[model samples]
Target chain A: MKLISVKLSPLNSKKNKLKFSVTVTLKKDVLDPQGKVVQNTLKNLGMHDLKNIRQGKFFEIEINEKDEKLAQEKVNEMCKKLLVNLIIEDYKINILK
Target chain B: MRSSVIVFPGSNCDRDIAVALQKMQFKNKMVWHKETALPKSDLIIIPGGFSYGDYLRSGAIAGKSLIIEEVVKAAKFGSLVLGICNGFQILTETGLLKGTLLRNKNLKFINKDVHIKVINNTTKFTSKYKLNQILKLNIAHNEGNFFTDNDHLKELNNDNLIAFKYSDEKGNTSNLSNPNGALDNIAGIFNDKKNILGMMPHPERMVDNLISNKDGVNLFSSLLG
Candidate 1:
């Protein structure tokens, strides 16, 4: 038996819950035209304190299992299949027991 | 009602949509891309295919076609238009639909059976179903991700233009199960007046219970009504 805990972020609140905090960020080479526009807006808004604001998604997931290794595998599979878009996004996993 | 499926040079799924419409008893016409005008019809379908080999961007190259001009006119004249897969991409390219179809989050060709939640059943394309109902359909594409601005999304939602949303097998419309990471898991949508509809899923491929599920047949049937 194993147990797993996952947390998703509120960055993309459209389909995600407001509470879970999982961080999914865009890859380095991917173009972020939207982020650039928002950055320009911030500068105009006098929030001159902001810099290099790249955009990405954050997610938090909770797993109920008995085997730690198996649970990790499941979570990783989910990330590969659905969560983290490997082509343009890179993801990091944080697990809690 | 007679129907026509506009066939671009690189469109692969044109035949499937044609077949589906044929099964529904609509006289289907295969209109070529160069045709200046669409044959008379109550509905026009821009089936999915890699127009112009997805050259510059998914639908960027196909947006300049002369046929698109007529299609736009037909839609404006109140003809029903349905775009599927690459057809959806083309709709965005032509500005008939809102938002853009970006590369898949994973950047791989994904093919699988996915669940879709009917969001707006008031449109002719989806009026056969109830809201929040789940239907299993097949999805195959590499550039199906949908993107839109926050203000535009809010306006779309408030205007009741959002048609269908992606969901899980249990019929949950959560962002977590968005296979292509679409905004609001929006599998399909209608125009402001509800005549034009575009979706990334292949409803044409789901017409037969022997080969695939028949969940999508109702969409065409509703159009007939």
Candidate 2:
């Protein structure tokens, strides 16, 4: 079993809470046109000295699982299922711990 | 029935919608953005294109146009309004619709012919189709991803405001539903009153059988008939 690093945050506070925070990104092979546009704009504005402008998704997830390992597993499952488009996106986990 | 297509300076699809209305034998008029009043019409259309060059946000600046005030009044009177693509963005900006169009998840200006399933056919724009039937139409846009708070999304669903959902031939949905890559695969929607229709696909672009699929003509015929 992979040792999970977890970043815990309160996503929604109700009778029961949901803790969620994840960052999903495009696969390296996929293009980032919006990032390129911003890069060009910056270049035109005389910032000609930057590199690797890629855009990615920032997702704040809210799920219910008390066990840290179970929470990590569930979050990973979500990334594979809906949070990231496997065909075009790549994901990395940032657990608070 | 009296109809008018509102034209802002950069709206390229105004004429396309007018032509569709013309084929339907509607007395369609072109109402310019500078005008303070719309001609007496029960149906109003705000067609697609980069209105106001899509500055600030996709349709933010254009929402404040002088002509839209008249539209707000008309909508209050129970008149019908249909907004397509950029027109949909403008409707969201003007608060006639709830939610905003975010940049495509892929962040690209995607253009493609996609399939849309009629989710709610009880509205004026979609009454021609059966529920869950798939229709083909073209989608062209960058700022077509729809976003709203969970409460609002729930309200839309509970109120039957969702008019269409984009899907594939197999009817599977996900991030993949957006052939043009819009959010939640939402292709169209109606206001709470069911009098306003806002869709991303260009029904006008598909009116002629030889040029494109004639699926769109049914919508007009249903409204007029």
DockQ-based class of model 2:
incorrect
- Candidate 2 segments exceeding 4 Å error: A1-97
Interface RMSD of 1: 12.7
lDDT of 2 at B126: 78
Which pairs clash inside model 2? A6-A95, A6-A96, A6-A97, A7-A95, A7-A96, A20-A61, B178-B181
* Whole-model lDDT per candidate: 0.80, 0.80
Q: iRMS of each prediction in angstroms? A: 12.7, 11.8
What clash count does candidate 2 reach? 7
How well is each residue in A38-90 modelled by candidate 1, as lDDT tens digits?
A: 79899999999888778776667666554556666777786675555454567
True contacts kept of each: 0.00, 0.14
